[model samples]
Target chain A: MKDMIMSYSDLSSSIREPWHMLLFILLSSWTLLLCVAPPATWAESDKITIYSYSSETSINNFKLLKMEFDSYLSRFGPYELQPVKKREDFERYTKGRKDCLLLISSWHFGNIGQTYSLKPALVGLRNGKKYQKRILTGRGASANVEDAKTARIASAASDLHTKEALSEIFKGKDVADRADILTVPKDIDALMSVSLGMCQYALTTEGSLEDLKQVNPFLHRSIKVVAEGRKSLLLILAFPESSGKVRENMMKLVKIVQHMPLDPDGRKKIKMFGLDGWQPFDSSDKLTKGD
Target chain B: MKHLKLTWLFCFFLIVSSAFAANRMPKVLLINSDASVSKYGEVQEAFKEDIPHPVVGVNLGDEKWDMPSVENLLYDEYPDITYCIGSKAYHIASKYIGEKDIVFSSVLNWLRLPLTRKTYGVSNELHAEMQIMLFRYIFPDVRKVTMLYSKRYTQELFKNAKDKARNMGVEIAGEAVFKGRNTISAFDRLPADTDAFWLISDPEIISDKKGLSNILKRCEKRNLPFFSYHEAFVKLGAVLILSVDNPTIGRQAAGIAKRVLSGNKPAKNVEPPAGSHIILNMRKVKAYHLKYNENALGSVNSIVE
Candidate 1:
């Protein structure tokens, strides 16, 4: 107790001057502000946040994709890649964040891009094709879509999107609700389900069928194309419509994406997302309008 | 005109012969112990994907066939290779198709299965070398790890893991508990220098949920990161998990089956699980203040936040 009283007396005695009191108050307030303020406000202001969600990549592999993307983007500035697993969460994160960029599936962008005022900046290319076709493959030799009614169809598409895509392919049959849909992890799994007699048909992409051909030719030859849907655009990198500083910052980030393929490390990173490279988004691409 | 007609006839014959040859390809009978189980179904689908020839699948879970009936069915189909998924399938198939090539997967402690020169298997558990190497990859500073095991369940596994750890400059110490009730106490008695706790697939050590919870709680109290062999343990506060990838195991089994069908013996009779599904519980990692290599996140199959 005596030591505490002496220490208090010493501190009080040292700050007896009017100038000392003003300096002490200023310093204490500054320290309090530093301790209480949210770190994001100050630390993240200069960091470029990129929110990504893709139905094509598995949830687990998305984490790896984020790591690779962040490593490549770090060369330019403070960049962070955040993986959003659900569509609702992606919408919540990117809806009002004008300063951030969204790397998402074109199907999803078509649904919400207009509502959010997002302008397509770049489109992903795979094997030199900007769009791909989804095919319904089966064992039968029929090109009619009505055969899918009441049939078990295996697909790798997200549950909601599968219904939409099926509605488009079947046109007016309402097969999405009538058909028994089995969800798998990858396109190959869906194709294999048809080959192994687990399902009546498989709703997969043309690229996946090509992959199966290379993997097992006999199984590939047995599968017949039941129907093919219209072309669907690949992944799109977009930014919100904004003005002034935010727009300037987004443009700079867009340039980085535009030149990413030229760099070896950046090319490797983009390849993790199953993309060959990036090209300027075509505003006239009808697929982006809707199904 | 005569030459053209002869060429057309020859072309027609070539097409017909190729179609006939395709029909004569060897068949494989895939006997699943239970197709109702999701993992079993996943394995079946993946196996069917890579196997080049036609596959005929029969679900033992869906059928009730007697010995004579099974024998009759085999005689009817007469598969060149028999691929069994679980222990039950392997047992029944081996009993009927004696001395033929059999490839099995998803069998626990596959060392117990009857083996022959023609038997090939994909072990259900990942190899000790792989687990330890992953541990080192994630936590380079963690030099010493401790695990509790029962003599009957994990004696050999512990010794093999310890040897593999030694080769990688990591020390793995094993504590034995004869009863499931003593699992927590055994964990409590772990050496103070233990950097981490590894939970292997030991029946006695992980027999009850309460015992497992107590061990994990003790680990938390001591600030020891828990490494487990199942994804379910992540919710129970496991910092890292290494589990077998069922689909990959199926593909691996298919590869072996293809090789054996082509008249080539596999380089090894029993191969360790090739693929591992790694799960990292970021919440537990942060709560425990564990140090892990950020670069290693690429290899993680799942993350629990």
Candidate 2:
């Protein structure tokens, strides 16, 4: 009985087939190759997702912007220009996601940073300027702040900055009651409302007004600025709190922003974002309470 | 043989007389309100290109000359035609240059100016229908537009805008703000549904800074966009403007001069300037948050940021 068991064990031995030796050698060679491979190629699969809030931005425009940014960052390697356009898409993409990047308005940055504690990577700079002022424009006579109590006002809906500024301007008065306020989703609508006499006045930013002038030259002569409001940074970029490879990549991207591309193609890409170049975001550049 | 000799002498005589006739070219007098205003140079250059006859230019407001002296000069020169530019020059030349063909230009509100059979003018104001058409082109979504005008200055324009606006499916609501009446409050009472404020270049309505400020404030309170006749008003927050192009107007005047020189009966009524330009302020577009119509924006002459 012992001799029969020994013969069976030998028949089933691992070296019974030559193919088993070849499989062992292949496995060892693969393990060795993985161990010796460069870190960059190893980390090629890791991706950083970018998201922009859909306020006035359209999906196609966002996609174009993504392409521009992706092309600019191609030299950096291992980065994807995956831009999330909608608010829901952003939430869904950002939920429990690691190594993510966010492009947010200064207003949203302040609001979201309180909970997530985001670290800014770089902020957009326009014509070498960083701050903008909110203002009230109306017909020449009734556009002033003093007349706002009884005036019909146009404002952007869901815009916290404009709301806050209006609150401060009409602090003592019952703004909700005294002023007949109409809220629209975009700044251009509010301005058109004022221009068309649908409303008496509008609240907007100086930079926004300048941008509007580029599209509607008639508004330059038609809208009279009645009052000025608080100043603030327009846009900012942030990285998630847990810093790792993303932070390193973000640092490199920030360096690129600091020294903007001089080529015409790079310039055209940057101009779409209303910026001539990028600037480092320091403590001084951080948003203040009123700003 | 004697008859042949007589015929040759007569032929020589006819040749010499024809040469003498060629030397006596018609004279044209060019009178400008302010010749130093560089735009007049453009007018002069354009006029010369079209009118080949000899021209004598007179600066109406020159310190070296007065209306009486200018009158004396006109009588002395007895020019075949007089070209008057600007309101001052037009008025002076009309009074001083007697009966000679007069072609007037660079004059604002030429419609109100006195017209004679011998005097034809190119007015700064375009036809009301043209302005209304442009407004419709720029703001297709707008249904109603409001204008504040003094009857003395803008009665015809107001009528024309109203008639044309109706045909174009747009409505024009105008308030007649008479001279010396406190017109500031008139802006406050603008139609609530007004899609835009049309500002006419009436001195009675727009000359007062305080009144203009009040009107602008009211527009702000109501969110009504402003439109105007002057490009300068764009800086004051007007969204759109249509103004006469001086050089183009000058060329048109020269064309009229050619017609008059060819013995065509000079028109007894003032005609709108042949050319004008549209200025758009896109900043106001952002301030009001209007939807950008790329197709409409493409038609504008100049866009201001």
RMSD of 1: 16.3
lDDT of 1 by residue, B57-173 (tens): 888887576567777888788788888999999998888785778899998877778887878988888777667766766676788999998898788889988886776678898
- Single out the weakest 10-residue window by summed lDDT for candidate 1 chain B: B293-302
| Index of the highest-lDDT prediction | 1
Local accuracy of candidate 2 as per-residue lDDT tens digits, B273-302: 434456778799778876544334323546
Model 2, span A102-183: residue lDDT tens: 7676766877765666777777776677776678888654357778766656665333445556776677434734444444
Best candidate according to DockQ? 1
Which candidate wins on TM-score? 1
lDDT on C-alpha atoms for all candidate structures:
0.77, 0.67
Q: Count the backbone clashes (under 3 Å) in each candidate.
A: 0, 69
Error of 2 at B279 (Å): 1.4
